[model samples]
Target: MSDVETPETAEKEELLTEAEKKALIALRRDEAAALRRWWQRLTLTPHELEKLTKQRSLPRGVRAVLRRCDSAEAAMLTQGFRELWAMLPESTKQTDYRDEQLQVWSCIALVAAELRKEESGVSLAKRLGQQKEQTGKPLMSELRFQQLLSCRTPEEFIQRLRRALALADKKGVSVVLLASVIALWWREHRGRLSAKPTQRLGFVLANDYFAATSGYSHRKD
Candidate 1:
């Protein structure tokens, strides 16, 4: 083997890196599409929706254990969650990101189960910003929205997210978008070190929230 690197070898290595990047992007797109499809199915099937919603009312202790992802208790307590997990892309079920996927999936199922409508197209943060209280303020206060983003655990996130989802349901926000954003948020949270500066999930959501709120406030004014 030669000690010195040749230009040809360096070019080959660069091309290989680019190929890997493209492959990763494609894989993520496929996974996201699969997740959206699963959420759409849940919305269309009333019986399945009913069963999943029941998981929300399970004892707090059981719900806490459900956050463990690998627990047999979670598997036994919610067949719906298991089915949802099974429907996810095989890459998501792999050991590498399995626990994070489950944590995100559980929260999505719980928050989405609270939705009264299954509409699509709008982002969750914008929908929340657009919704108004009877007193003519944004339904989700800035303080509350900040708190939601600041949650330190899955349990806290789910609890606040369910309340937010309920308000979103009143406005008929998109269930698919809602679930997908939460999934994206979880991925960003877990991989913050590797995430691009332009792609910060919190910044994206804050933009959506504040932009909508600004427009809404102006209209109200």
Candidate 2:
């Protein structure tokens, strides 16, 4: 009878352990679902969501660099790189050969990509600087002259270029344009702008708004 009682108690303990494990798994799933919903609320597109949702936590130094991103767009790019790198297997990451050093290289690549896409050559050159690193070489010719020439209007192109420059972590010729935009917004929309960094981003959005408005104009005046 004593032996039977001991076996029965052991089986009951195992059942409780299994029940606890199920509860913990349910809790983790619930937490993950809540995180996904919150991320969706941040206005990430499907592509961006896929990139960000799969990342492991960044190392402290890398996370600090990402947090220091000057623009929301740059921050998005940083997040993209982090998630992309994290998705790579440990062996793949080791083969790529830079572990933590990859963050700085990735920063340069991201800034270069943005500049090339936005046709901000003058700013790109300044950001690339006097001492050229191997990472900077990959971007030198990716930014083409023809892309800048395709602009419909000089002002439109300049504004887009300025926005890209403003996002760069380094000093560049277009820093003046960035400062001017900030000052203009501060003067014109004092009440709305305030101390909020995001409010100052109206300059970038204003370009799109103006372009849309321009498209609707008829020359009948």
Q: Which candidate is the best by TM-score?
A: 1
At residue 69, candidate 2 shows an lDDT of: 61
Mind sharing the TM-score for model 2? Answer: 0.20
Give a tens-digit lDDT track for model 1, residues 158-179.
6777778766654466555666
Query: Which lDDT value does model 1 have at 161?
Result: 75
Query: Would you give me the overall lDDT of model 1?
Result: 0.56
Q: State the lDDT of candidate 2 residue by residue for 114-152, as single tens digits.
A: 321221112233332222243323121224322432334
Model 1 segments more than 4 A misplaced:
1-27, 45-77, 133-135, 191-195
| Local accuracy by lDDT, each model | 0.56, 0.33
> What CA RMSD would you report for each candidate?
12.9, 22.6
Checking candidate 1 for backbone clashes, the offending pairs are none
Best by lDDT: 1
